[model samples]
Target: MEINDLTPAEQQVWRAFATGAAVDFREEDDEDTAEGAQWGPERTVRATVLRALLLNGPQEPGEIAAVKLAGARITGVLDVRYGTSDFAIRLSHCHFDEVPLLYGARFRQLNLSNSVLPGLTAATLRVEGVLRLTDCRIRGPVRLGGAHIAGAIFMDRAELSAPDETVLELNHVTIGDDLWAPGLRAEGEVRLNGAEVAGSIRLNDARLDRPGRVVLDAETLTVHGDVLMRKVRTRGWIGLRGAHIGGCLELSYARLSNPGDAALRASSSSIGELWLRKGPPMEGDLNLRRAQIEVLVLEPEMLPTRVFLSDLAYTSLTPHVPAEHRLPMLERDGDGYVPYAYEQLATSYRRVGDDHAARMVQLAKQRRLRTTRAWYGRLWGYVQDATVGYGFRPLRAAVWLLSLLAIGSIAYALHHPHPLKASEAPHFNPVFYTLDLLLPVISFGQEEAFAPDGWYQYLAYALIITGWILATTVVTGVTRTVSRQ
Candidate 1:
C-alpha cells in the first residue's frame, strides 16, 4: 500500500486517516445526493486504499486514528475477514461497488450512515463500539449471525430489500445494548433467533413486507428490556416462541396481516407486560398458548377470528371489565373446551375481588364444558343449567323448588284422594299432602296414609318424579362447587 500509487482523492483520505478527519467530496448543494454523479479524479477512492489504512495506520500522539470518508465512490472489495483493527471506520454518504466483507473481523466501531451498497456480510464480526447503518439503502442481505456488539446498532430509516429471502439475520448474536431500528423498511425476513440483547429492541414505525411468509422471527430471543413496535406494519408472521422479555412488549397501533395463518405467535414465551389494544383486527390467528404474561392489555375487538389461549396465564388484565366482556374472547379460543383458560380468567377476576364476575366465568366454563361431553352428559348438563346454573346461581335452584311446591299444592287442592287407612289419616289438607309427595326423603304421614285414584294418582306420581330430580340436581351442584374449591 504505497502512497505514490494512490489517486489524488485516495492520497487526501490517507493524510486525514491518522487525525480522524472527514473528507467531504460532494458540492455544497449536492450534499444530499448519492455517489452516482460523475466526478473527475477527486471524488473516487479505491477500496484497497481504505482497507490498507484500516489494517495498518500511523499512530497519532493522543489523537484517535479513524478512516472517515464521505460522499465518495468506493471501488473493489474491502475484504477484512479475520482481521483486527483498533480504528473506527466511518464511511457516510458513500457508494460501494461491492459488499464490504468484514466476516469474523474485530473492530472498534463501524458507521456507514446514509450510504448505498449492494449488501453487507459482517457475520461473526465483533464490534467494540456501536454499529451504525442509519439511512442506508442496501439491495442485499445484511447477515450478522454470531456477532457480538458491545454497543447499540442503529438502523433508523434504513431500507434492506432482498425479496423472498432473509434481509437481516441476527441469530445467536449477543448485543450489549439496544437495537434501535425505527422507520426501517425490510422486504424479507428479519430474524433474531437465540439472540441475547441486554437492552431493548425498538422497531417503531418499521414496515416488514414479506407476505404469506414469516417476516419477523425472534424465537428464543432474550431481551432484558422492553421490545417496542408501536405503529409498525408487518405483512407476515411475527413469532416470539420461547422468547423472554423482561419488560413490556407493546404492539399497540400495529397492523399485522398473515391471513389464515398465525399473525403473531408467542407460545411458551414469558413477557412482563403484553399490549395488543388500539389496533385494527388482525387477519390471522393469534396464538398465545402456554405463554405467561404478567399484565395483559387487550381489547375484545382486537381479537382475530381464531385465538389459541389454552394454558395462557396472566396475573392481571387491563380495563378491569366484567367477565361478560372478556368471555367472548375465550369463546374464540381455537383449542376448544380448555377448562384452564376459563379458570385462569376466573382467577384473575377473583383477584380483583369481583366475585360476581368470577361466578359468571365459572358458569360459562360449565356451558363450554357441555359442548365437549357425551349425549347423556350433555342432557344432564342442560338440566343442571336450566335448574341451578351449575351451582353458580343458587337463587335459580330456590326458584325452581318454590315453583314446584306451588304447582303440586294447587293441583292436589283441586281434587281430594281416598284414605288408604282411615284410622291412620291425620287430616285432608292439600298443602300437607303435596309436601309429603314432593319431599323425596321425608314423609309427613299424608302420602303414606292417603291414596289418589285415576287422574289424581297420575298427578301424585309426576310430583314424586319431579321431587327426585330437584333433589339430585341440587346435590350434584353442591358437590361440584365443593370439589372446585
Candidate 2:
C-alpha cells in the first residue's frame, strides 16, 4: 500500500513510518515524551492505519517509528479478516472506539500492550508468534474461541471486566506455549473450556471476582504442563472438570472463597499431582469426584468442611496425612458412603505401607455398605462389624470371647448341678463346665457329669453360639489379612 494510495489517516501513519518519527496520541505527557522535539506531530490514527500496516507486510521491530497511538479514538472496526501476514504489529497504549475484529485472520505476531479496548473477537484467528496484551484494560468480553496460537498469550497485569459472562473465552483454542497472565484482574469468568495448551497456564497472583460462579472454567482442557495458580485469589468456583494436566496442578498459597459451592471442582480430571498444602484455607468444597491424580499433597488442617472424593484415585497422599483427617474427607461425598472413595483411600494407604490405615478404610467401607443393605443383609453386616470390625479387627473377636466366658462362668457358678447318672462321680466345677460348653471341640469331665436344668440349658446354648461366632470371626479376619498380603 503506497502512501499516495492510502487514506489521510493512513498517509500520516506512513509519513511517521518513512521519517522514523515517533507518533504521540496520549492525553497525558510522560517522561519519554516530556521533550516535544523528541516526538513527531500528534496524529489520531484511524482503523485504516492498522489495515495499511497489515497490507504492507513484515516490518522489523523499530523499522517504522514506535507508533504511540495511545488514547487515539480510532473509529470503525479494525477488521483483520481471512488473510495471512508476517508483520509484527505493536499498537501499545492505544484506545479503541470499538473492538478490533480479527476473525479467521493470521498474524506473525501481535502486541497491544498498555491499551484500552472494548474487547477482542479473534475466533479462528491464528498467530504464529506471541500475542501480548500486557497491562491492557479491556471493558468487554474477549472471545478467542477456536483460535490457534503458535506462541504464548501474555496478559500480565491486565485488567479485564466483563460482568455476568466469560471475561476471557478461549474455548477449543490451541496454544503452543504458556498463557502467562500473572497479576490479572478479571471481573467475570475466565474460561478455557476444551482448550489445548502445550505449556503451562500460569495465573500466579491473578484475582478473579465472580462469587458463586465459575471463575476459571477449564473443563475438558488438555495442558501439557502445569496449571500454576500460586498465590492466586478468586471469590468464585474453579472448575477443571475432565481436564488432563500433564504437570502438577499447583494451588499452593491460593485463596479460594466460594462457600457452600465447590471452590475447586476437578471431577473426572487427570492430573500429574495436586498440591494444596501450605496454602490459604479453602472455604468451600474441593470436589475431586472421579479424578485420577498421581500424587495429592494436602495439609489436613487446610481442607474445607466438605470435600467430595467419590472415586477419586491417587497413588500417594503426601506427607502421609493421618487416617483420622483423611477419612473425614471421604465421608463428605454427595452420594453418601461411596465404596470406591474408601477403596481409593485404602489403596493410597497401602502404597505408603500403612496397612493398618488401609484396613481401617476397608472396615469403614463395609460398615457403610451395611447402611444401604437389605434388612437380612444388614443384620449379617452388623454381626460382622461387631464381631471383627468387618473382618479387619481381629482383636474384637478376642474381647467378645472373653466377655462370653465371664458370663457363662457366672451363670454356671450360681447353679451347680449333679451328674445325669446318679452313680457318676460328682465332678461339678461350674467354671470347668462353662469352659467345656464354650469350646466346641473340647470336652471336660464336668460337662459329662453335670446336667443343667431350666434356663441353664438355654444359657449353655447361648454360650455355644457365642463361642462359634467368635471363632469364626477370628478365622475370617486372619484369612482376609493373609489374602490381602
Candidate 3:
C-alpha cells in the first residue's frame, strides 16, 4: 500500500517524519526537539510504525512506529526524545522504503528481524533498546550520532550506505552489540556481520566496551569506496575477516584494540594507510596475506613484525620502532604475534603455526647478513691467493714431492690408526680427510705443493715459532664483522 493509504493519524505522523519531526513523540512540541530528541505519546507510536515499515516497508509512513505503550514493553524505533520510559519492542518480518528518521530519540527495547527495508535513513539518532536490523536494505547514509543502544543491535547482511555526500556516522553510542539485557537494556547479541556499504562508512570515535566473543564481529564489512576514519578507536576484537575495501582505505589515527586474530587482511586489493597502529591477539594469528601498502603509511612501533608485503609489492624490512619515541607496551599481555606475515600470502605457503613463520623470517634475515659478509669474504680470498702465489714459487718441486709422500702416509695412518703413530696425534688423523677432499680442487699454481703432513705441521707450529705467519694467514681468511663496520 502507498504511504497515503494509512489512517488520518498515521498520515499526521508520516508528515512529521517528512518534516524531520518523527523523533519527537506525540503530545510533544517540535520546538523542544527541532535540533535534538523529545519523547511524547506520538513519537512512541511513530517508532512502532518506523520499525514495521523498515522491516516490511509497504507500511503506511506513519503506521509503523507510531503507537502507545502503557507498560515497559516499547517497540519499533523507540522515539523517546527526552522523557525517560522503559519499553520492550519486538517487530519481525517487515519492509521499508526511502523514508527519513530523525536522529535524536531514545528507545527502551527494539528488535526488527527478518525484514526487507531498503533506503532507511536516520538523522540525530538515539536509541536505548535492543535495535536489530537484520536482512534490511538501507540505501543511504545511516547516521546515529550521540545515541545509545544498550541492547544488542544486529545488522547481518543489511546493505548500508552514506552516498550522495552523506556519511554513516555513529558518533557516541553503546550497545550490548552484548547479548543479554532486559525490557530496558537490549538483552541480546548485537551482530552486524556480512554487511555491505556502497559509500564511505564510519564508527568514528565509537567505543565498543564488550569483550565476550568479539565485542564487534563485522566479519565482512565491504566498502565499495574509500573509508575515511581519522580519530577512531575500538576496544574489542573487530572482525574484518574477508572485507573487500575498494579505493585507498585510510585509517590514519585509528586505534584498534582487538586482542584476537583480527589483523587487517586487506589482501588482493589496492589500498593505502596513513598512520596504522596494530596489536596482536591476547591469542590467534595476525595476517596480511597478499595485501599491498603504499608509501603513504608508516608501520607503527607497536607492530611486532618488521615489514610485510602489501599487494604483491615486496618492500624492505623497516624497523617499526622509531628512533624518537618509546612506550610501555613492549611486552604483549597475551601469547605472542604470529611471527610471519610472508608465508600466509599467495607467494609463500608455510605451515600454520607460529614456529614456521619464525623459521622463514629467520632465514630471510640470515641471507641478508650473509650478503653483507660477502664483500669482506671477497677481499680475504684475493689477499690469500696473492700471498700463496708469491711465497711458494721457489719451493715448487720439493713441495710437490713431499706432498705426494704425505698423501700415502696420511691415508695409511688414518685407515690403520693402531699403527703409523696416528693414534698419538689428532691433527695427522684428519690429514687424510683434508687431502682426499682437496686433491680434486684445481688451483692456479701447483698449489698442490701446499698439501702434506709436514706443511700442515709447519702451519700449526707457526704460532709458537713466530706468530706473524699464522696471524696473517688466519686474519686474511676470516672477515671480522665488527672491524668491517
* Error in Å for residue 158 of model 2: 1.2
Question: Candidate 3: minimum summed lDDT over ten consecutive residues — where?
Answer: 180-189
Error of 3 at 95 (Å): 22
Candidate 1, residues 157-194, lDDT tens digits: the string is 99999987889999999999999999999999999999
Model 3 ranges with Cα > 4 A deviation:
1-194, 260-285, 290-298, 304-364, 367-485
Best-first order by lDDT? 1, 2, 3
TM-score of each: 0.96, 0.86, 0.38
lDDT of 1 at 249: 96
- Supply the TM-score for candidate 3: 0.38
Two-way TM-score contest, 1 vs 2, winner: 1
- In candidate 2, what are the lDDT values of residues 249-323, reduced to their tens digit? 988888999998899999999999999977767899889888999988988767888888877888888878668
Candidate 2 off by > 4 Å = 1-12, 16-41, 57-73, 280-283, 374-384, 403-416, 421-432, 444-446, 453-459
Compared with the true structure, the alpha-carbon lDDT of candidate 2 equals: 0.81
Per-model RMSD to reference: 1.6, 4.3, 16.3
